[model samples]
Target: MTQDLFHPHRHESHPKIISRLKRANGHLAAVARMIEEGKPCLEVAQQLQAVESAVRNAKQALIHDHMDHCLEEGSLSQQRAELKAISRYL
Candidate 1:
């Protein structure tokens, strides 16, 4: 499969991040199943919040690695583009 730029390669570079993400994936799948089964709204909302937090944490880790490695050494134009793309996260 062709990995896009946003693909989470950092997780492979650091297994801890991958493990965190794997746990989050299980949580996400469970939440989805709960929603499908008409679980309580409040419980679903809580699960959604947990998923959002997990995604943000994963994204932050990836961004930190990208900035420290790719963007830092890239040319000015590349850095500018990366900065613009990264801003979308915020």
Candidate 2:
């Protein structure tokens, strides 16, 4: 079987990532409502920007935590491969 990266504990940043994603989801729903209600374009765009930023930040945190937990502890080839794989998202 393949190894499990997470055992008894989860990555420390997971909680923050989940929180960010939840906020982003809420903002996205609000933006949809705002659209249907004829809100100003500028206000809608600003809220979209906030949602995008939250998602981006959460993704960054997850990647950083992965690097810390995997890259820092894996074998040389594994670390290089992992880093190369994750680099595409950046």
Candidate 3:
């Protein structure tokens, strides 16, 4: 299946995005460990929710950066691309 274009080219091209994702990865691992260790379900759910929120913020940051750096001109194509990017979140 095709993934969202919101973060396309991020893994190979953007160091900052990768760094943010690595942090999120650590959060996910911690959440998983909490579940495995029989931590309270509500607590683990909260941690997982935090991870999701962090990822959403990371994606928003990436989109904002792309607007500033990759599509600075604010052209129609850029708008369309950004729409496509943002659509992934829906």
Model 1, 2-69: lDDT tens per residue? 24788944434467677779989999999999999999999999999999899789778877766666
TM-score pick, better of 1 and 2: 2
Residue 24 lDDT (model 3): 97
Ranking by lDDT: 2, 1, 3
Model 2 agreement with the true structure over 1-90: per-residue lDDT tens digits? 126667544777788889889989998999999999999999999999999988998888888888777677658888888799897886
Clashing pairs in 1: none
lDDT of 3 by residue, 1-90 (tens): 124878554433368777888999999999999989999999998999999988887887776666555554467786777767765864
Candidate 2's displacement at residue 62, Å, is 0.6
Q: List TM-score per model, in order.
A: 0.71, 0.85, 0.66
In angstroms, give how far residue 1 of model 3 lies from its true place. Answer: 22
Best by lDDT: 2
In candidate 2, residue 19 scores what lDDT? 88
Alpha-carbon lDDT, every model? 0.79, 0.84, 0.76
